[model samples]
Target: MKNKSLYLYSFNQRKGIFLLLLVMIFTQAIYFFWSSNTTPQKDKENHQWLALQSHVDSLKQVKEEFKPTIYPFNPNFISDVKGYRLGMSVEELDRLFAFRKQNKYVNSAKEFQSVTGVSDSLLAVISPYFKFPDWVNQPQKEYVKFENKISDVKPKTKIDINLATQEDLIKVYGIGPALSERILKQREVLGGFASMEQLAFVWGLNPDVIENVNKSFAVVSTSGIKKIKINDLSIKELSKFPYFNYTIAKEIVTYRSMKGDIQNIEDLTKINGFPVEKLKFIALYLEF
Candidate 1:
């Protein structure tokens, strides 16, 4: 009787274990089937997301391709007939020629509305690209037609730097009474700039204004100053000497660094852009 009872218990335990195993296997099969099948709705969402991403990428590429080109159109002006050079970069020639009167030209892209002939649609197109150079000012100044007052007769020998008064300085374009006083003050302070760059150091001289006027002034320094430092001179300052511009001055400074200190006047020949003739003129006043 005891052995039969033990055998019955063992048989029941085996049946219970087998039933649990069968249930686990059935649950795992259902999970695997569901995971393997993708729903149409989910597939559609993925496809749409990929298409949207591709379209965005294409638009980005198009913007990048045209980023370098300049386009000018005042967005306000719909009438295209009156607008000339509607889609062009501002050239120096354009700046000079576009002026009908002094200070009348549309400078800022936003200022296109002020132009007399610009239509609303044309201004709308040009507003984005039509920025004014720093020199252009608004509330237009009257165009003083250049009077060739001193054409044939040379003026009473160039104004003497040592003795020139405030009135003397205002005769030159771009130099005002205040700036003229400042120039004299700087000369007194630094014992003269030892170079033209000193004018740039004046309290209120605008760099662009200096550049424009520098070409007209000739250096008559009889004081025998020599060897102006190229690296220390400002563009307007360096430009006062004959045949020197910002570009040439920059090249000289660069060459001085690359080749080490300029050894002698002849050493300038090794630098690009410094022609022999130019070097001869420059050698008179330049030092290492």
Candidate 2:
């Protein structure tokens, strides 16, 4: 009986140990299954992160698309900083500045490139944004209207180039605001236009444009001219004239001081660099 009791106890202990192991494995499996299914909070956080990532990516795309907008601007007045931003090199900017320092302007894309020495590639990129003065793009009137009781035929009125305003000049084909301003500036410097041929001297005025200007305008009166008293004027005063540069002015003053007084326009021919060809034009602005 004692031996049988001992055997039963040993068998019970082994069975208990096996049951304990089975229970432990079942609990571990339950924990693993529960952990595998994500919590609502974790799931929500993951969704939020994905949404944030997508939004950031969209913002990056928009930023790329909206970057650096270029606008229409005048290339003539481009500063060093502006030129640099436009891909112009230091040498190119210096060339442009040098041209401008002489009171010259770049009126066209070709002239701009010629002055700046920029590459064709850069010119192609920036030329489209070059906004010239407004008058250049304006369409001129092809015909003039007349109100006459007797005849229906309307004759085009001739404008005086010397008296014409910027608006008036733009009415002529090929004369834009910039060229019109240039014409006025040239006329101011010379005192007045003495002849229709003087139109050829206007900067950036092409042959065809000059032809159109000639057709539309005339020098009707010499009364508006401002003449200089050559004999009494100082070298500085003489140099102020468009025709007489500093060197020529100094020579004329020197000649006057030595020769007493200038008798006539013919006497100026004796001076060096007198611009003999332009004597007639220069004569209009000088007095004895």
The numbered model that scores best in lDDT is 2
Q: How high is each candidate's TM-score?
A: 0.28, 0.51
Predicted model with the maximum TM-score: 2
Clashing pairs in 2: 135-176, 135-177
List model 2 lDDT by residue over 79-116, tens digit each.
98999888999999999999989877777899899888
- The worst-scoring run of ten residues by lDDT in candidate 1 lies at 74-83
lDDT of 1 by residue, 86-201 (tens): 54333422443355435344446545444444456755754566544333533444677877777697654544454456676666555666677777775564333344544554
Error of 1 at 188 (Å): 7.4
Decoy 1 TM-score against native: 0.28
